[model samples]
Target chain A: EAGVTQFPSHSVIEKGQTVTLRCDPISGHDNLYWYRRVMGKEIKFLLHFVKESKQDESGMPNNRFLAERTGGTYSTLKVQPAELEDSGVYFCASSQVRIVSTEAFFGQGTRLTVV
Target chain B: TQLLEQSPQFLSIQEGENLTVYCNSSSVFSSLQWYRQEPGEGPVLLVTVVTGGEVKKLKRLTFQFGDARKDSSLHITAAQTGDTGLYLCAGALTGSARQLTFGSGTQLTVLP
Candidate 1:
């Protein structure tokens, strides 16, 4: 009955360094989503996974960002050689349905600061 | 790209006052949702309106979806200090139901 959970509530790293964020969705949830909110911007979708398969990743910012969901249990988002602009709050959400109308449980989020 | 615009980017009012926040978009959506986010936390779903012209209420909060399915509103009556938070509106487009287009958010602070 726990909500979605994310690791490293906060992170600070030098520019050009790599950081990985992890998300564990609620038990038995099949749909997991990644989102980011840059400074002064609204939260934007980064990608979505359905049972270990990426259903849509069109929102991924660039090749520098990589997201994987292995075994359909958890997800990881890696930003390699991150740029200063990559500093933002990354959020993870999960739901039992693929439709957007369904309620999605969200995590506390991981705030990444690229200095 | 589809974008949603929220009015009164910031709002501060004394407790017991009524306030309304609007979310407008040019594109139509299959559904629209409103959320409240606190510091250090992600957004929490407040309500979801799937049909045009639908209105739903939760306690002192009332949510309405536009007839065109391109706009929505949230109204809180007799607000309390606990009502203070960042209010966000997101829409799932008719074609791309997997992604949500979000508004910049309206920061509401209700002082007691």
Candidate 2:
């Protein structure tokens, strides 16, 4: 079985441009999550999806950030009109457990650079 | 502000040395987890401590949860170069959200 996979491991976009990050979770996993790590900061939670339904999205920064999980297998996070502060490493994770605090497998992460 | 506070944000030690990293918080969590991440890669779960005052050991790494479930610690014995990476601590509060609040992370560099 393959671990969680993220596409375009590295992305460089100009400020005000739009960038979409994708994540393909492990097969048979029901819980998928998105996180981001800014320079010199802790990795922060973005959102979570339980199948195709968004379980929680309180971590979303603003309306410019949109995350969708179509069919509950893959997830995409789109940053519209990206800003300089939006440059960071975006991570995707998945877990087999339906409950909280379980072991989660993470992807290599998409390093987004907005200059 | 970060819900979890990890001390010694960076540490450099020689191989065969022992070190202990700590994670603290004012808010009690239902469970806590420790993860390690190398360059260009995502974090990998090291261990999870659920019960307060519980202690679990994996190989040379020992994890301990606080008596009140508000803190945890990770101790590495005879550290190896392979252990060099970023160590992160996360806590999960009880509720349906199930989101894990992460710490700032400790970057450990073990030199041979």
Candidate 3:
């Protein structure tokens, strides 16, 4: 079975530039999540999608960040006019979304560096 | 905000030694999970403890959940070089969405 996969393992962009990160979750999984980890900081949750609907997006930092899951398949997170603070590693994970503890499989993550 | 605290931000020890890492929080959680991550890779789930005071062992690693469901511990016996990585503990607060609040993380190094 294929695991979660993310695009552009490393991205380097200048401030005020726009960047988009993509995530392809495992097939047959209903739950997809986005997370971020800044330099010297632990990983933090960004949002979660259940199929095509967003289950929870309370973790989104600001309006500059937009996430879309078209057709409930792959997800894309776009950062407009990225700032220095936007430099971090973005991770994507997928699970079955069950009442019981369903293990979440994470992608290698996209490392973004905004200079 | 719910936060998980991890002790010993970093640890370095010789192989074959034993060590224990802890995760604590003031808020009670419905479930807790442990993950190990290597550089250039994402974190992998190690174990999940739901019931309070529950204990689960994975080979040389033993995991224990606090009786109050507010704390947890990971004990590694006969640590090996393969065990060296970043250990993270996450909590799912009761009545909240499936989002997990992760701890500060503990970096463990096992020298060969």
Residue pairs clashing, model 1: none
DockQ-based class of model 3:
medium
TM-score, candidate number 3: 0.97
Report the Cα lDDT for residue A53, model 2.
Answer: 96
Candidate 1's residue-wise lDDT over B39-88, tens digit each? Answer: 99999999989989999999999999999999999999999999999999
Error of 1 at B17 (Å): 0.9
TM-score of each: 0.97, 0.96, 0.97
- For model 3 the local lDDT of residue B85 reads 98
Q: How many Å off is the CA of B11 in candidate 2?
A: 0.8
lDDT tens string, model 3, A1-115? 9999999899999999999999999998888999999998778999999999999999999999999999999999999989999999999999886765436788999999999
Expressed as tens digits, the lDDT of each residue in B22-72 for candidate 2 is: 999999988999999989999998998889999999999999999999999
Report lDDT (Cα) of residue B106, candidate 2. 96
